[model samples]
Target: MRRLSTIIALFISLSAFADEGMWMLGNLNKQSRQTMKELGLKFPADKIYNPKKTSLTDAVVSFGGFCSGVVVSNDGLVFTNHHCGFSAIQQHSTLQNDYLQDGFVARTHEEELPNPELFVRFLLRTENVTPRVLKAITPGMTEQDRQAITDSIMYAIQDEIYAKDTTLVAVVDPYYGGNEFWLSVYRDYTDVRLVFAPPSSIGKFGWDTDNWVWPRHTGDFSVFRIYAGKDNKPADYSPENVPYHPPYVVPISLAGYKEGTFSMTLGYPGTTERYLSSFGIEEMMNGMNQSMIDVRGVKQAIWKREMERSDAIRIKYASKYDESSNYWKNSTGTNKVIRQQKILERRREMEATLFRWIQDTPAERENLLHLFSSLELNYKARREAGRAMAYFGESFMNGPELVQLALEILNFDYEAEEKMVMSRMKKLLDKYANLDLALDKEVFTAMIKEYRSQVDSLYYPDFYATITDEYNGSDHAFIDSLYAQTKITTPLGLKLFFEQDSTYNIFEDPAISLSIDLLVKMFDIHQVIQEPSTNIERDERLFNAAIRRMYANRNFYPDANSTMRLSFGTVRGYTPFDGAEYDYYTTTRGIIEKAKAHAGDRDFTLEPEVLDFLSSRDYGKYANTDGDMSVCFISNNDITGGNSGSAMFNANGELLGLAFDGNWEAMGSDFIYEPDLQRCIGVDVRYMLFVMEKLGKADHLIKELNLR
Candidate 1:
């Protein structure tokens, strides 16, 4: 039924030298291995990934399913990005013992804080399941039918594996668009605990101001321990659990990197759309990104201003603010680079090449041309609806904390009265667990105002009508009144929300009613774009297949889909613009200078003792050969969002640092990789050891690591 697999090998990258692919670890061919060796990797290919025996694959962890982590000690010590573990650090904090502000250190095993629901999954293996997945599609099948069939097959596969082993979970993910599928199985250990963390001054030194910037000084690393049952198998949290012994735990290399030192990163990168057509790129730039930027710009402004005045608010909302601002700046940088690089024009040029390459096959060529036309038309037809949807998402689903509670309740299945009401109350309790209500009200007002101003009434909730009718069109006054009058806001109403009463009509509450209406309207917009979005998804897959045919001579790596991927390149710097060359690495000197530059800024102002220690020339065994302490470094290794906290290793497969970010100029790397401009920013291993040793005084933890 016309799977693109028959047309061409669905390639995921441009060329070998660009180091542009989030290469599948299990799928590395001989040519890929040769290329890696040429770049700098010293290990034999099989040594890195062998299912029969434990290898480097066992050392990496799917950090909380969102970010990446690596096993440092055989005792299950997992090292991940501080930002990755930010929520857990914040969760254990209190006004009396503010872990977010003071940072955390567990000298003994019992001191390590247990985080509920936090998990680390080890990749069991990845298998190509394209034929099995594609068999679900039939001629004349609707997108809905195609999806339902595929989902059932995938669920069956996962269910079979789960029935065999309770610890194992399986996922079938589509890659190279939907042209290919891969099944990945993992062993999830649920007893992960926070071990060590540096103060915000160290962990998140530059804050949002330096988030995506290069020459980064932030340590950006956190430590956790994975606890397993008596047999070293996955288990729920228990006092009897012991540290897990990994199959392989690479040593930390004290000898630092040269400008051209070889490096590699193995992690799960969430997503990348390197094969998107010109029309899709333009649609995202003009509609989706703009709406996201506009909506978040308002929410973050209010949230950030309030966070500055109050430490309690800052601790409560730091993670939320970081999450919102991250993509806000990402969309900002994405649009900027697209304009500066003329990315849309470049994509059209590539498509033109594909159009000419298949001129000999009239039938195939016509189909290719029709695919392009459909993509352009589809993107154009759904432009306004897509923009409205983005606004709705950024405003309600993400902007207001109450909306999160509302959506959670709407999705949960409450069978009995007591269970339903008690569950609802649990949600209420958790809402205040991490969120500050006063700040939420501030955010709610700003978000609703911006959403109303930017989007049409067609995309808004029925509550907008109430605002116009009962509140005289004043969003500020309406939101304020809603918060003041909503039953959920009152203690009695909250108690009732948790009480054993199935008669509680959650929809009768103003906040819940408004949230439901907004969500319902958002779903309406979603329906309007569904057809075109489905068409785009299908056509994009075919387009990439066509691209593989046009560039059949070049080697390709599959696009990342939150699976284990390996990429290697040299530690190198770049020239962001003419006459401006950035060094490959930054030292503690840069940190001190930045701290001085933004002296009064909370983002840059470090604790006086931290700054004094850096300036005191206490560079000991961990110092770089140049006599300055290395803070962070950059490499050309391919990585993306979920690769945060991935292990960055040297030629000998020894740990060098933790991959935490990519330079700002290459924000569009997700869409198109420019090897010349792109760089993976990592926290040097020595700095992490230094922080743990000097600041945390956790020498016992350092002694556990195999330091070279």
Candidate 2:
């Protein structure tokens, strides 16, 4: 293993270049500033991030920590992706009032609907405190000891910051794999409301078929308003709360941009493993990604049937389906791009160069050799465990709603669990109408079959033996029996079970028993895999430190960890194939063409009113010079999952579009950035405005943006 590691590391070469980094907002050094200037940035670096003054960073916010949004008006009107607000929209939709089917536009502030548990956070400032953190570590400290000390120091910093201002949330984030750390402060606003959202036909145009594909026409934009107390501080949802007055609001630009234009994006990008080793990449491609794709494909197949059959089911399952399908398609695309781009092979070559560099430098060689060897050995050792975890996660955790409900019942106190279960049951039945027992049973059976086939029997739950012996190795029989025997499958049965004061043995329930067994097996496997890796974290920190030193001359940005970041690039197009070239911008023509192609399909069908606007070509002021309404545009900006609702600004720092998706060819960007091929897909601000004004007749929203 050591010999193989050394050989592979000896051939590694660094390939960081172009607009390929999610740069820290507080650490825009001289080199990064120069790069941004060269890319056509007109504003000074201080204008982008100023603690004492309102800057561009103040306008960008973390939308519920999972996506990004921008403050577009002084009254805190937030702009984000429709999919980011999907769950809230679904919550408000029903057969009589289906906002997901027919678009919704809040004509007045009073008309807007409040979303429960929704929040947006504005970044106050970011400060580097690596020195203070590392001061707590001693030379002879073990990895666990170092972690404990680090956590203590981090808590101390957070406490100190919080003591100064209780409203501000202070978080110390580790970067460069724990070699560095930054302290970020944010003010969270919880009283967010839905202002506007186009129907699924426009917001989710092409649906699963066109999710990650380029030349997209999906509007993908939603508007929400953040409300605060009379004092203008963060507050819970109340009628007394007023619209928040933001420090900065992005100025909308009606002048549409073209190819080669300078573009910048700011958002909280979720995660990226750009420095992952070849072995890790191999495992992701062959194990994790493939498992996700296969399992989600089976689950979605079951859901689609139920959703298509009933409008109520469609609303209940819409958000769930979208969440599952998004990553499923992403996994499929990542696998394809990884293979097409030879990403694993390239990583191996890069590792070889790093090993050669380390050997040449004796200081680094002695320090990092063991780290490299450990990485290789650890990955090999944990492959089976990782695969097992993936199977377990997909099967039990993400498979059916029933499994999760069962797990909840098993884990919580009886009285508290009863109340929670009763509340959930009432909500599911009242809001979603009914939980489809047949569909869930089918899903459970399918998932179990896949889990049994993919994961080793050694890691399998004991319930599998019951299924095999008692049910004659039949997943169908096992699932049918479980559902038939469990009262939790029915609303009345759950209510009656909760109402009864008699002590109930949750372990006797088939579903709860199965879930508990699965949980135990998963935890046991995880422990077995992690028990041997006592020094892995320390070794990784050292390894990352060495890499940073080796590439000291080049600019290094930490991997995305749901922190605010800025990425800059040019509006560019690519020839994904030998003879086919993709244009940088897509127009209304593509939407019409898609609608015509799939006339009766709900995913592709457009509302008659929207189609009429497209046919008339009366774009008003939203049309580009060619007299065509631009829908979506592509750029080479580096982004990932959490950047879904990020604002795309032009050279002058004016809002041009909302970054929503990454092209399918760029799906592997989380691992390796292909500057020429990777593209960020954004819905044009003009299209959003057009949808608001012409289709939804949201004049109030248009005025709120204060368009220039």
Candidate 3:
């Protein structure tokens, strides 16, 4: 295990990078350039990210990946990526209407459509569960013991809390080594419906070739509404439900952002790996890069071959193929940049500096070196575990039933993991009846063989024992013989055999069931022991320390993952990749021009109806940028995955455009907030209203926008 000093050094360096680095709050160090506060900005008290506040209940309601919308007229009206809304567009698509290919508008409320698996989540709350959780077992607990203790304590806590409101759920987040923890709560509403979507021709003017690389003109925004019971609280979708009214929704503005203007992104920015060790970063750069190259390259080769042979398959996997290719290609470029820049070397130096500082300070020195060593050990374990987890999640594709079974098993503590032998028997009979005999036999045989090869062989010698007999298609015979000998023909007996007594032919049992158990154990091991040993606690301590430092220095409110966050920025652009400069704007006319030049491709065709509307040049509800009103526009707000459907507002918090995509150069914004490269693009509510009112002839929606 690496020492605490070593890990801290690595952590500080990585966190100071280009994309994933977190900026200190309140512009203390950054004031020389610009600050969010300078732009006449005010973040709502409710929206601030305060670790102590503990509830990020409101997630930016988003449709697809690109669009931006706010939860206005609250019955959960989510405005988001137009491309994000594409699936819903396709769902409403038909021979008669073909919304995806054409686009449609709901003239009346009755004409509004619903799509499958489309929903929005409002972050209900978050909790710092550090004391309550860590109280179960102290640091340095054994893996098995740690797993058992955590499960027992966590289950007890959740059962006590969640029993009241099913909506009140919890997910544990390991922070700062094992010293700190957080529990995120969510109010999940599954019944989300599409309120409006423009035709794809207008929404995705340029498609894949133009996706990340944007000169860029795509009005990618869509709208959906959330429904709940009459009491204004969350409830499942029902015929009696009504539109949710949000307590606060941003008001749209005709005023737009100027270059150098300050902006704020007030939504959840998923995760930051800024605190990783230099070793960790190198592994990813080397390991993940190689993996991407292998998988994506192979997949691309296969896809291209299949595309030549089967057009139908090509169309079916078109999105996936493009996504994989883009991921690999971009990753290749990103990795190269990461490697050549000596990012790892710089980070190592930073770690050493921090260590020297810590060692010099006797007042705070608590001999954290042992703790750091433990962290290094855990990192090694985690890397191995990650590989295993990836294979299990994607490649193996465990059956839903087995997944459920595994979750159920892990729901219990260590004693439960060992003692639930009989429960396995009861489940076996039911599962056996459903298993496809041939598939099960083959799958089980292969799984055991693989486990024996990859997993610690000492823990799984019995799995390898059955490989020979099972391969000859004698699995059933072996199972019957084992049952006869053990006098434990029940499913419980079979499970006990696998769990406790590994002498028999447990090979007949499902691999998924065993895999699930293994995975649960792995998670338990990680959370309870390994995670504590690593940087989780140290990171938390550092972050909290940093926060305290900021509070003392600037009196800034510490950032938290609360229900809302208001980040203010401006509408500026920058140069990316090869020094290609991007100006801060794309106009409505750009959409029309792109449509005119389109070659025939499913992702890139103009709907005749929309073309006709564009040809007419009506500009009904469109707000003019300067004297010439343009429909779609851009801003420079630092938003990521969780900020979908967030409203972009002007000085008085009036609606500007609905924010959608960030420039490709800003994908790194997920890890780091870059003022220069990151740009938030949105559809002007004015243009959206214009399209609905004039082109789609849907005065009803225009009326809904309340733009009398």
Candidate 4:
């Protein structure tokens, strides 16, 4: 039954709802004519502005990968994903000051601690590169040729600009296969600092278990400031540098919109998989979700155990634990929904209808479907074997060591990349090797024994080879001699060797290097080895067929990823799966209620003096009684991860709220936008003001806001 269930899940893996398409933006077609007309969302091409609509480009910045943010201040004061800001917060954390667990706010400019690795991107310009780009390439071009042409054109464009603006970078992005192109110029700043954040209790109120599940009480938002040169240009860390002062910052309106008001979320959205094949959905539903669930479940257990016994581990893995727990819940929830199958069936029907309508020949359709199918099959073939890469997957954890090794290699004139690879091997060897020969042999033998006992033989071939070779080799005396010469014995001895030896090379020794080489070879083999070409061909045919069909309908576009897209919707409310309806409201009262619940909980423990203000409902000091909106509310705006810190604006261009999260119902927006299910949650400007005035007791900060 367990095996059967696992097989069933593999077929359901592609159930991404919110992942691939234009979020919930496709509902523009299905929107009631009355609602659409009321929203006045039919902004024509002339009025619509790209990032550089005017002197002030909507600061398009990526806060690593989990989320995105926008610059609300001209002088580089940016807003972005709360989750995105997590790493920065974590980086700044120390034993004495747990910034991740406790929120941080730097009241003064000098008070703000510079986050060395944090970066913000300014979208300088974007242009259609299709004509110039495609001129050098053609339809029958191979992927290699297409990439070469694309890279050449991109380099040419960027090189020209790089000469003018050394701070800026030009990236060429592809759209509609190889037919269309967008060349974008970005000004990047590395010196960023934390501005203000609610405690984890408030910022991530519901924590990971609540992520991607709507009716969410989690306040998933954060703010950051980008510092630049005194002349308003991007700059590195400098005490002399100042906050960027832009010509325009969004003006916050006290008069919040009611239901049916026109609203839009404008910011970078990371990725979408709306164009994925049904088989792809099955993979996500079964494979990705299940894998994530299993991993996160283990992580959560570790976190739970550590949270109770080890403060150090809790501190170290605060963000990781939160993420794992959240993903576990989210994946499980998503898996559950996919298993329901109604949504998948609906999506399949839509795909079928699209296929029937597209003017593609049977051959073309077959080719597309084959493409998608091949991808799925390949993924499955590599699925379990890919676990070898997991231990070294995170760029954040691995990047610094690689960077140091690259610098060392640079000293010897070796390529930085090659040095980094050597550094990786060095680390791996250190992990498995020992310092004292007898103990080393014992440790290595025991470790290999564990590997043999635990890890699947199919995955850990190199480790398996160690145990097998010890027994099978005729040179038992040679093995004893080698073991005696070996330095490593106990785990601590091996660790000490790595710590003390600065000039060890895993690649220099034949036995060690060969073993290391085998690991790498197997890792690669696991990553790429797949079913025979016949299955691959069939999958591609399936994908091409699906795309042709989807294109035929033209009812929905493939989901946009990290691509600029405009989503239109209205301020509204939604009913949750549990039959509870959320009104377009959240108030200061809710904040106080949450605060009182955690009288001393890190998220809510207000200073004793502040409690008096809440009791008095001294809202007059902070609350915009005019609209009386709770600090947070809902709007029917289609958005995703990239839309963090997006300014939610009214028709007259007044900022109403900061776009944060989509209601739980809209989690499916990742794959397919269901208008009825999609609603954007935001922190109203009024609530922001109230928090600043009443709770924060920093009414002085209000002056910086462009309040009308």
Candidate 5:
């Protein structure tokens, strides 16, 4: 097996001074500490992450594996972004009790709503398991064989760890690609409850329109409480479970920060491809992103119309719309930033430099050159299949809700499928009572057209031929017919279909038939691209290993894989474009201004009570020294999708805000960090306190926080 030392050295040679990486909590080095100190971090590195003693890392939790949250009170109060908890809020919402629209404030512990599957995981510890795992691989081993051996070893290690501690959820993650591996053990608390949330007027103040925009006034915060058994251990939701006493809780700081104030963010960042080659970037920008944007645009258009028609439909699809629009806008912003920033050209330049450096080192030249060539070829070969897959994802898989239900029903046995089918039918009827068959039909039709036009004819599903020959090439007519003939479209049809005998064939249903055919086509495409995708992964692993070796002396952080990480920076604003400067923070005054500018607009309209409070300027203790109520603030802290709900701390490690969104101009920061432009948007802690006390009138909940 080849070593990665050479590549690390090469990477070190190219390193420069820039705060651009997500440093893992347990792996901070002396240089990282020094950098943090220079950037205004007042706490020692050990104080931030000490396995033997309670530290800041103990306060941070992986919120259901998708977002980050912080423990705020001794009694297990957790703080995160409202968007992070939106799905839970949606689940508990209904027309009679619209928690999403009016928000919910648990005045007493008994009032807190329980979530069925929500969880918060705290890191126990991490150990380097690279050598033990790598011992399984040998030179010239096939990728499949290598993966199998690695998995077996990893599972064995995890089992060994679990044997000693049954409470721990053990996971092994590869860092620097497969060059290094670490075992992370976590204690997952399953009994999480919604404590408090501001109405959508404040929580989702600007909604989709101001999603990634800066100078934002949205108070995008939500509160949840973690419950544990009497033993203070993880347990299922039960009335007997009490508020958990965490090892540490973040102390809220009302001392407002200004431009250049030191700040740090600790959370789980989902993913980044900072080491991607220009070939990969081109494929992502032109193929995957474009397909998602186009397809989701069509889906969202239909959903918006149905949702606006009634409050019930709006409640049913609020989370779905938010989730879909988030990435739709992300794809749009990323493509725009990629072009505007000339990221491809920059990557090409870096590749050129790397190649030149490799050539000088004859020992490494051939291997490095072969890796890049193979990667480029693999990406080129799979671009079309990738685009086709993206379209399939956006269309039949995610376009209409009924298609997914039909596919799920097909997966179950007749004897066991009845209960599942009945439950699904009830849910479908209850949630989507205003089922817009015509709108869904239109969306499905448009998506199918997109897939046919974008993907090659050779890759078309068998049903395409059925539509073209039997239905006369009319997707609209075919989809309309499918809806009319499908059992899952309505509760009566579904119940009637389930009444059939064991001899009944689900494939006879039009929706089920189309779904199965599409699934088969997707499988076929996957088979076609399997080899190339495998080769790409293998080459990327090698490439990452080489980079690690080249930068051996420099402090390197792994790309975020939904694990806890700490990123530090300062509170500073930027000029995203020439002659347009933004302030470091937004205040309640700005919210009022925006409300006035877009009065009656759903996205900008404030609740009448909130409007009245703003009119009187009665912020009380939550007001800044300047007599203004701070809402949102921006920091140069590096963050991504999963960092939402992460704790933004001041120099003294006091809670400053909850990290939410990143600036639009820095959308490409996931792939290529633009230090000057990339900024983390957070809802200030003061704003949360103000909303809880003055607006929400939940001073009891506010009293739980250790305010400074």
Candidate 6:
């Protein structure tokens, strides 16, 4: 075990140059730059990130605050993952013109559909704010106090900027497990509009089945244009808004990638726990991930059954179902990898060395002894509560659509006069306007029963007593009574209730009471776990600092926190098991093979036109040297959730593809980087162009790209 740990640590040192760290752009070290150059970086490090001028970083945008994207033309034409733009596409969809089903392509600027809530933000600057953040920390201050001091300083810095221009978003994020801090200031353009999207059949070809899998045929690309005021500044959605002209636009390389070609991805990777203690990783595997997998399985099954019954229901629940299933499937993969690889035991072995190093010197032992002790204690203390929290969140907060609506009502300002309060409630309900009452009723009942069965009686919502005493422990009966008493469930009742609201008190309603109980129970769990969780967080931070000191000669990258970062590697494949070797790229032939193999399958079902198109011989402009179109390829770039839609660039700093997913074999790499198996799955840029131009017939949008 010690030998294995030492080998892994050494491999991580070597792999740092291959595809390990999500490096900070603001502080590109000399050592990293030289390595990148040796690997075929065409320009200097400044070309990738330069604070004084527009660099490749300027072209990258945080898509709708959740995913990453790149500006492909001077007019701010953004290319992101189809999934990243899915929510907006679904929102704009209607039965009359189903964009989600049939796809949308605007022929002219005027025809483009506006997404008011969606925005893409550019990285204006990233500054090291470590000194400012750490200066106020006292020697013996509690973690909470230290955090409060950090927050005050961060707020003061951001508030000063906000006073000048509210559109300028500034966030001070902790790095290296709060050992250091950096501030990222961004320019957010909110008037983003959909320009082109392929039908779901192409954009999301294999759906959940193909997600996180290698050799993917999913096109997984969407196009949107950022709109700004006449001055090219951020503005609200309006008919008069013009296409945003960006400071820089990334050039698309039509040339494809070789197996060992140098590749890099720059994006906002959501989170990673590479420095997390073994105890924390085990908790994540057995507790949070397990609860998510179990609860979402039930929810997806229920939603799928309901959705298949009616087109109306399908359209209403498409986004909800996909969101749930994607993560649900991801959690299952993470746990599988953790167990198969014995990740928990390996982590413990690594920690053993870390502790042994601490004990070698009395000075080191004196300073860092609390790390393991406190982490072990608090992690054990919070184990059950943490699992309960995950179950409560999955089953209660995210289960039923009406349950979410109930939460919204809980926060509603009911103090307004009758008509105002009624209007507000109607508006709030409209936020989830597509929810099917029947489907929600079924889901809500099942969730209540599932929660009760999974968790202890102490964690039960106060409303559980009503189900037990009044309804004889019948979830269906209790749920039925709640809905029956709520006027909003029926159109006529809602209308009448809205008409005469002066005498009505919704706070006394059964449904409202049930929501309150859910909130109160969630709060109780949070309260119980707060102290222990804090201790664990503090211990982890101390552990992270100590590990860095121990490995002073080795490179240590901070765990991702949804900030702009760059990760580099080669376009290479790997052997997953004893005898099986995977290719670096999957061609168009695989698409036809998959479509035919799973002809009647919903996930593999492609539109007849798309099938015929793939079946036809010539891949034309997108074809590689073998005269076959590249669908997707694999690399070892470190990426996570938010890296979806990020531009994958070749050594020449030209676009190769879009970083969309990570291979399933390395799903647990978020906690522990699997140097041998970890590979980034990306949709070939040429494939995206082929779909946009040949399949979608969006030549105007295709022509707008600065193709090389």
Total residue pair clashes for candidate 5? 15
Candidate 3: deviation at residue 334, Å? 4.3
Q: Tell me the whole-model lDDT of each prediction, alpha carbons only.
A: 0.84, 0.85, 0.51, 0.56, 0.84, 0.85
Residue ranges of candidate 4 with Cα displaced over 4 Å? 1-38, 41-60, 64-66, 73-75, 135-157, 177-179, 308-312, 354-456, 464-503, 506-522, 530-558, 591-616, 621-629
lDDT of 4 by residue, 441-478 (tens): 33233333333333355545442465357656323443
Which ten residues in a row are the worst by lDDT in model 6? Answer: 9-18
Output the better candidate (1/2) by TM-score. 1
Could you give the candidate ranking by TM-score, starting with the highest? 6, 1, 2, 5, 4, 3
**TM-scores, each model vs. reference:** 0.95, 0.94, 0.67, 0.74, 0.93, 0.95
Write one digit per residue (lDDT tens) for candidate 6, span 380-443: 9988888999999999888877677666766666578875576576555555567777788899
> Which digits, one per residue and each the tens of the lDDT, describe model 2 over residues 605-667?
888977887788888999898899999999999999999999999998999999999998788
Runs off by more than 4 Å, candidate 5: 1-18, 411-438, 492-504
In candidate 1, how many Å is residue 440 off? 1.9
- Per-residue lDDT tens digits for candidate 5, residues 304-401, read 88888888779978998999999999999999999998888767666666666677777778567677788889998998888778777777688777
510: Cα error in model 2, Å: 3.3
Candidate 1 Cα errors over 4 Å, as ranges:
1-13, 415-428
* Cα lDDT tens digits for candidate 1, 193-284: 99999999989999889988887999999999999999999887888999998889978899999998989899989887787888878888
- Candidate 6 — which residues are off by over 4 angstroms? 1-15, 413-430, 488-501
lDDT of 3 by residue, 1-708 (tens): 456655654444333222222232222245412344455555443333343352222434423323334665434556676655664565455456656555666655455665435555554545667688767675666556765766676677667667777776555655433345556554555566776777666776676556655666666676677766787666655677777766555544545556654444445443344445555565565555545654455435555565446544443333445445655655565466455455567556655655555566564346443434554565565665544443333212332233333344434343555324444544444344332333333343344334344445333323234635563645445433433443233456546644666654443444434445556555653454356344443543443353233224432222222233345566666776585666666666676666667666545567677667766666633645454446555566655544555666654445666655555655544333445556676666666666656766666554455332
